[model samples]
Target: MNKSNRRKFIGTAAAVIAVGTAASAMPLSTGKENYPVLHHVFFWLKNPDSKADRDQLVQGVKTLKKIPSIQQLHVGITADTEKRDVVDSSWGVSELLFFKDLAGQAIYQTHPIHLEFIEKYSHLWSKVVVYDIIEA
Candidate 1:
């Protein structure tokens, strides 16, 4: 290798290493927000084949985002993917809610919006399953 070319390569590599070292010494994020409570709800629509029913349920779930205690909300229909024994894609719609703590989730459970949502859209779902998780 030419002397000049080798020197340039070494310089570039040294610069990259120095930058990486500096980055490693610094905190990657300003602050970390933790949500220890996860509320996952799977809804089996009475009319599973009806796109309209699924859409209505998704829209209703989206409204739950208005609840102040919910840190994050995600709503979606079953994914179209390869069949697997562990993956239950039978649900017509699903809602994954994040809460800072159990108290936040408790407030969300009885929130007016939640009660109204159940009253208005409960008929669309024939079966509902909820899994609540708390990180240790």
Candidate 2:
């Protein structure tokens, strides 16, 4: 995708990573605390060619911001631009979420809104992948 075009994947890997990422952060030996976790989720749709399915997924992701524990939420899709050897374009939709701390993330997991989102939208995707990053 071009710089002007923006969109964003991990598949079956998502659910496992989402839960594990918060639990698996490694602190620097210097003792700096990990204050925030960046949770990036990738979704490969069962009907990757369907615009309706992809749009619905993106909208569903937007609803996650209602959860108080989520500091930020961004919904995106695959971009149409240059394909690099390292770029992943298999997924149709992606969400980048921010949480203040692991506790916040844990709360988000059980939050009614988050649960509802999964129940309502899980069927759209055939696979999910999640990546969690903590600032060094």
Model 1 per-residue lDDT at 27: 75
**What ranges in model 2 sit over 4 Å off?**
1-35
The lDDT of each candidate is 0.95, 0.86
Locate the minimum summed-lDDT window of 10 residues in model 1: 26-35
Q: Count the backbone clashes (under 3 Å) in each candidate.
A: 0, 9
Choose the strongest candidate by TM-score. Answer: 1
Best-fitting candidate, scored by lDDT: 1
TM-score of 2: 0.72
Quick one: how many clashes does candidate 2 have? 9
Q: List, residue by residue over 1-136, the lDDT tens digit for candidate 1.
A: 9999999999999999999999999877856569999999999999999998889999999999999999999998888999999999988999999999999999999999999999999999999999999987
**C-alpha positional error of residue 118 in candidate 2 after TM-score superposition, expressed in Å:** 0.8
